[model samples]
Target: MAARRKPALICCGAALAAAVVLAAVFTALYFTVLRPRPPRVTATVVGTRVSAFALIPSPALNLTFDVAVAAYNPNRAAFEYGEVVTVVRYHGDAVGEAVVPRGEVGARASAEVRAVVEVDAVEVFSSPYFPLEGIAGALPFETATTVAGKAVVLGVLKIRASSVVTCGVTVYPLRKETTSPQCTSTVHVG
Candidate 1:
């Protein structure tokens, strides 16, 4: 009777150990393989400064801002080559944002790149009625138009540097309201 009891206890202990191991493996899979991926870039705006200038047709609001974006590649995969897009908000209004693609990052590793964003005044109130005048028939400024009072979104930025390049973006925000020739405004970068 004693010997029979010992074998039964041993068998039970082994079964319990196997079950625990299986549970651990499943938990790891759920956290790693089954979990959602983290963002490619951790974005941060160090600082921002705006310089306003008036274009002949409208004023140009140039934004000079310092930005920092970083990421962690655990698998050590080919993530060095990725994209970084940032959206800047000021007074509840977004000034603009930019994205850096993988192609640009892979070219350089562990480097911070500088980006410049521009906001124009004329573009603020730009109207199709006032199609840009071209020497032959090419109106470049037309494409850069923006409605007045509307938030500015600069689109995407692509860059590469040695290891990491941390720089600034000079953005031109155009507002054509003519409310003030100075066209002074506040900008929030993040």
Candidate 2:
């Protein structure tokens, strides 16, 4: 009976030690990888110009816009992002959409993703409030853009982050030029 009790005590001790080791690993991972703050995101308009409106049958506007979005990882671990999708809205109406190429951002590094979307007059007309002057004349317009993707840390812990940017820009069709939009973004982590 004494010998049996000794073996049982050893087994219990071994199990307790294993549990402690597992707990320590989980805590370390939480502090070092899982709990890191989300990355910072920013966007800017580039090479966007208004095209001449086609008014032969009806009023139609065509424009090409290029928006460059950058995600700056502030954590020590690299962030691997899946495919990113960006949607551009005018007056709360979706006018254009694009998909960003997927890639990994190294630790404390930033990755620039470019999305080019073409907007037409039909999309603009869909909005209740159409700024004809802004489309025809040299007035500025605002676009609310959202960028969403899944980010992983060390290729293990994964989380979803989205960034929203509102931009004020002007496109000159006659001159075939445009002013870079002013954009501000907020990041949400889940």
Which pairs of residues collide in model 2? none
Top-scoring candidate (TM-score): 2
lDDT of 1 by residue, 51-151 (tens): 55444574344544445554432222222343544444332234455555544222113444444444332443253422332212212220011111111
Which runs in model 2 stand beyond 4 Å of their true positions?
1-35, 54-58, 126-136, 149-160
Error of 1 at 108 (Å): 19
**Cα RMSD, model 1:** 13.9
Candidate 1 global TM-score: 0.34
Ten consecutive residues with minimal summed lDDT in candidate 2? 133-142
- lDDT tens digits, residue span 1-190, model 2: 9999999999999999999999999899888766666778787776675666654566667887887878898776777676666666666567788877677788889889888888856877666555565456553556655666665666677777777877877766657776777887888898
| Candidate 1: Cα lDDT at 38 | 24
lDDT of 2: 0.73
Computed on alpha carbons, the lDDT of every model, listed in order, comes to 0.36, 0.73
Q: TM-scores, in order shown?
A: 0.34, 0.67
Model 2 TM: 0.67
